[model samples]
Target: MIDAIMPDSVRTAGRALQVWDRWLLGCTFVLLALGVTMVYSASIAYAEREMQNSAYYLIRHVSFAILGLVLMVFVMHTRIRWWEKSGPFLLLLGIASLCLVLVPGINAHVNGSSRWIRLGIVNIQPSEFMKLFMVVYLAGYLVRKQEALRNFTQGIVMVSLVVAVIGTLLLLEPDMGTLVVMTVTVFAMLFLGGVRFWHFMLVLAVGLGGMAVLAVISPYRMGRVTSFLDPWADPFNSGFQLVQALIAFGRGELFGVGVGASVQKLFYLPAAHTDFVFAVLAEELGLMAVLGVIVLFGIIFARAFVIAHQAEAAGQLYSARLAQGLGLLFASQAMINMGVNMGLMPTKGLTLPFLSYGGSSLLASCMAMGLLLLIGREARAAAWGRT
Candidate 1:
């Protein structure tokens, strides 16, 4: 009816949006569908306990999913130039938001970490915004300073100083998890941008060593590291989360116990809807579902890199690096979340991209996907002489 009342040109423009990669879009929505199901299954009891309504969590999840979907569509149509031209502003915004989260009264603390700013209805997690903004800004930097990146003083040092400031603020929030993800993603982008191999390795080593030292010096981080190493030894206290995650995986030998049937999500597993959703998925849907989710993400990021390479072949260097960075960001975080669920790594607050139940994560992920689509479309258009 709205279309009927609107101008024909407007209707035509509305229908002009195209999907360059069906696999990317398909896999993402499939994960979102599964996420909706699992979030309800995992959060029903917890939400009831907290809100007296079983559908409380589910309602919020769906609401955010809808909002994210709209944002995804809107972003798909946004001019790619806007992203590049506004890179510096976005970076400033990211930095300011991160600093704001560290301020008293403005920042919201959940589970002891102040990583969010309450914005009336939704809590904004600046780190998520930082991830996307940093990628775009760094990609533009690579394009502008491609030649200078080979210099030891000009390339890595400058980048390191910038990230160090961001990293310090993150540590103040005590959100080491986001810091780790952001650090790895930034390095991956730098590597793709042709930062000297020796420089890359040297900085990587220093970064990892510094993170280790920070972890060792903090009692909270130390406890987590120790728990990850031997959760069984402290199963009742420090190791409880990992132990329960392991139990969920163990219970999911072949087929899952069936949706909503996992015993662990019944207060046995903490963060069943967020950090540990993959484990809850394993418990309910079993190995097949687990492999399926992995394959979906595999398709997503594999296509992402392909898009990056295609963009490169078409002489869009910034677009290429942006695609690579976004792909690596998704791939790295997904692997970490899954590894933590399987007890292969220390538990972190990382969400499994679209599969986890968080409004900020979902929206940010969808926006990333939109960027990927935009990049892919531009690549194909340039290849076909449309540019």
Candidate 2:
């Protein structure tokens, strides 16, 4: 208490460091730095061939990372109440960005999906921001509708419609991976907000049914399913990526081959720096390095959960829920990416968070990390008292 009598600047500095979320900030920096190093390693070969520079992807990814860090710091220092105030505006912006991506002149096309908007200097993926926007808006929405949560007709049906609208737009991107992750994040937050059991069950049933229909309607998705069931059926064709990914892990027994020494990255493993980066990581860094990555993510989740609990205990429910939602997002996306690499699940073109090489994804990851830090900051402030 005597510290309150100290100089204001020193007092504020002490308060910021003592805040509940310094650990999360530290962890995020460490993971992000590691991600930069690995992205450079995984992308150097491809960048050199395609872009005429080994540092092409690395430079771009690092640039985005820097931008993301700035966003995180800005958000961390912002008031949570301010986010709540701007919820609808953010939601509208997210939806508009999504719609713009579908526009002919604006949207950037990659592979088969038109999921980005080419803004003069950079292509922006609105869906990435939509992920966080949906989470924050949903949290605020659910909190406002808490009284109605126990109501069967008003709450349940209403939320289902909300999910349907968002799901439809996401599916239009034909990004089943992001849609699935977003669905899970929403449902989890709603469930924890006391949305009730039967409602979740009903939503799950409808969602799965919709997913099935989507899969059957798309030839490529159907091929993914078929390939998943029997990758060896078309060993040299549709199954090549999985087969190569498996071989990457098989070769990385105990110690890794060595950092940046991956043979698979020599153009054999498709998306060696993006969707299937984990496979390249396994091949180059070995099994232990892969395990290390898993461990790092685990620590991140642990820290996030701790922050959530502390925020809740400190009476900051919004901050608490925000932390939890971000944690789930991180955990779920990582699991999906890793599962695809391991062939434990059907392939979904989801980037492995910060570790993957993609501008939109990297920016989105930075935004999410920023939100997490914001929540952490509030939790810390509440824990230690305002300076």
Candidate 3:
């Protein structure tokens, strides 16, 4: 109806604005809304017991969701070239923040890991932001050294050195989960950037070996590995969390008991609203809901790759790599979280993207999605310009 009255130029401009991928954006908002609802369902009783308010976690999560959406909109409006230009500086800042979190008296330790920096009312996890920054920096690096990536000495070695340094910092915090995600993202980006097949395999082997060594050296990690292998062996201690999670899933055989009626979230399962929210979701919403959630994530991942391929076809190499990296980042984290919850992998503190209760992860995910939409827009614009 507005189109009928609007001037030609105004309509054209509006149409251009509509070029951004609405399906991707819709999937994002659906997940966000689902996250808010599930977070409330999973945390209300716990929050009331611990914080004396049933809405404590819900309120904070809503606030963060609002902030994340705003930031995402801001990123969508910003030019991608600006990100490319600032990538290095952002990476350096990320490194500095990671280092700062390890320093005495400045970092906040939770569950025996120092990974957060308290800023007045909010505690920021630098590693979460580091993932986004590393994507930006690597995208730029790949664009700058596309040809050199074919050479092991100049491309593979140099990128590995940078990743090693970052991995070292993360290991200091003992955040093996984030380190693994970061390593996989970098490797995928390098591979997509035309690095030789052999080089990619070699790096993959080294990364897996390093992670194995790290797991072996830490008793806590080794215990987690053993527990993952046989959570039933010590159901009361090391296996407690996974065992409870499995119980949640088993209880939710088909249709769940009902939303907000999860018995496990009352106290049985740990981190119900944060890391293991998916388990709570499965417990309360059932297999259908679980499959629905998986399908939603699948849509996001598939659309992201489509956008990447489109951008690459349009000669937007940086945008292509960034989009691909973002896809992998989201898919990998979600898979890892679900895998941990379902006993397929060792328990990791990785949150499900856009569906877990965490300010940093939510904000970073929104920003990444916004960047992806922007890349899709540019790809469309470039195709239009060509025509």
| Best by the TM-score measure | 3
- Give all candidates' CA lDDT scores: 0.88, 0.79, 0.89
User: Over the stretch 1-387, how does candidate 1's per-residue lDDT look in tens digits?
Assistant: 322422112122244433357778778779899999999999999999999999988998999998998888788778777898888899999999999998999999999999999899889899988888988898888888999999997779988998999999888987777888888999988888888999999999999899899989989888999999999999999999999999999899888999989899999999999999999999999999999999988998899999999899998888899899899889888998999999888878889999889988999999999899889888876775643
On residues 1-387, what C-alpha lDDT tens digit does candidate 2 reach at each position? Answer: 213422112245444355424455556666677778778888898999999999998889889888876776567567888887787788889888888888899888888898888989888878888888888877677767878987866556776777678778887887888888888888787778787799778877987898899889989999998898888889789998898899888887778788888888788888888899888778777788888878877877887788889888888877777778888888888988999999998989898887888777877777777777667667766666643
Per-residue alpha-carbon lDDT of candidate 3 for residues 1-387, written as tens digits (9 for 90 to 100): 223422112124345434668678778888999999999999999999999999999999999999998898789888889999999999999999999999988899999899999888889999999999999999999999987888998679998998889989998997989988888888988888899999899888987887898889989999999999999999999999999999999988789989988999989999999999999999998999999988888888899899999898999889999999999888888888899999999998899999899999999999999899889888877876676
Residue 318 of candidate 2: its Cα lDDT?
A: 75
Clashing pairs in 2: 20-380, 256-286
Model 1 CA lDDT for position 121: 80
Which is the winner by TM-score between candidate 1 and candidate 3? 3
Q: List candidate 3 stretches off by more than 4 Å.
A: 1-17
> Worst lDDT window (10 residues) for model 1?
2-11
Candidate 2: regions farther than 4 A off = 1-17
Question: Each model's number of backbone clashes?
Answer: 0, 2, 0
